[model samples]
Target: MAKLTTRGLRIDSGGTGGGPVTIAAEDVAGALGMGRLKPQAVLVGRATFCDDNRAQLELAKWVQQELHRRCRRNGWKTDYCEGLAQLCVFELVHPLRCVHCLGRGQLWLQVPERRGERIVLVERWRTCPRCKGSGRKRLTVRDRAAVAQIGKSQFADVWAERADAMLSDLYGLQDDVLRHLWKQFADEAA
Candidate 1:
């Protein structure tokens, strides 16, 4: 298997055959390699992006495991830890985008309109009820506390700070991975 690494971008030929093959810059060398592919940069960029996304997901799982460990050490129940950890992972991976309007802050509703001799359905835009025009999901303090498996006051005082730090680290990792992928592509293009 070919292994390639540039900065933090790694592409190893060790995935299932059905999945995308992450080809690195080194793998593009020689006649029988990816050099034969026209617009090699675009294909390589896509593969690199996919690999980075997979890496981010793995990092999110690590964050969940760390959160679960903290919960156990803090005497939280084991049964709740798994679900709460998963929730934290979801929040870490997905941005605070509204699911209802898909972050558009508006929805198109079909309403009945009377037009002379017939009733017609007209599409009208309305502010999203879930996000209330904010275009972002409302993750309340109560909900955060629930995920932390602690009282609201305790969560605000202690767990909130810790969780925020963890989330920041995860975001930083994602940013770094993207930067690395971009750098790799730039190097390849040169």
Candidate 2:
């Protein structure tokens, strides 16, 4: 008797005087339903952004458009205004919890045991290794582009603050664009 095994399927007999049998790649893939292996990607702000924040980002986009319109109307010269708006919006949104741990800061492990002819599964929770029990992680990035863009926004804010103060001291009022922009930011913060 000859035995052949593929993915735990055992063949105990070969009717022909066969040394080996070859299987086509397509046949195996079709049998395993490999065509359905890939999933459609979901569009979102950050790779690590949670579903709960999706609606918040949408609302922030509306605010960003409003700010952009106001800035344009005021003839303000701001580089990366669109990117800054998005980064500011994301910053305002609450920090996302660790996707690996699902905000639980812990992981549930399944242990299987054989009991007679049946398998019993048990689950236990332990601190998540990825989050280190903090339950949060910074957003995932494809590269340093996101970090650089965020840095630009921080510098813009600082420069705007100084320019606002200087303009106010010289003219008895702050720059209208900066005042309006910060007001919108404060509203979003609240």
Candidate 3:
């Protein structure tokens, strides 16, 4: 079971010592209240610490149903709908770190600066070009196509759009869970 507190959100991790895991309120507030999507809050959104994983399961089921409906409407075979939905949910829940920036979403570049007739290199951070500051790697076309059981051309032409929609819905589900956690924290504080 998980408990929301003014200090933090506590979950029984069932570790070797049987101690509960506590996530700071500040972290929760930053991730949920400010929509920063910090790692701890993301884990919470995955329902990892909860006794029942109904929220995530329900959202995944919704994604699968929506994808099936869209595939039928588009006259595409729905045989791979479950796999496609699973892929989308996995992307939403466990996004890979951007390799380019090493998940920092920024790069430290040495810039030449002139100070008192001397040239010195100063380190400055810039947003990562590869991930566009998102810090997450995108699913490749080949992988997505394989998951959808479609050719790359067809996936690129039409299936990708449907996949993106399902991904968006998964994001919405995460946001909704975060919002609910935020409300619970607020209520606890009151």
| Index of the highest-lDDT prediction | 3
What TM-score would you give candidate 2 relative to the actual structure?
0.27
lDDT of 2 by residue, 1-190 (tens): 1111343222212333223332332332232222222111111212112233554455445545645665677676555455545543453334467889986777998878788999999887878899887575655442113632545455455433433332223222112212222333334444
Model 2 ranges off by over 4 Å: 1-51, 95-154, 157-190
TM-score against truth, every candidate = 0.42, 0.27, 0.58
Question: Worst lDDT window (10 residues) for model 1?
Answer: 12-21
Q: What is the lDDT of residue 149 in candidate 2?
A: 59
Candidate 2 displacement at residue 14 in angstroms: 81
User: Tens-digit lDDT track for model 3 on 1-190?
Assistant: 3445666676443232344555675555344444445443454364432322664566567678878898889898887787777678667666788999987778999989999989999999988999997687987989878766678898888778878887776666555554555444444544
Error of 2 at 150 (Å): 7.1
Using lDDT as the measure, name the better of candidate 1 and candidate 3.
Answer: 3
- What lDDT score is found at residue 20 in candidate 1? 20
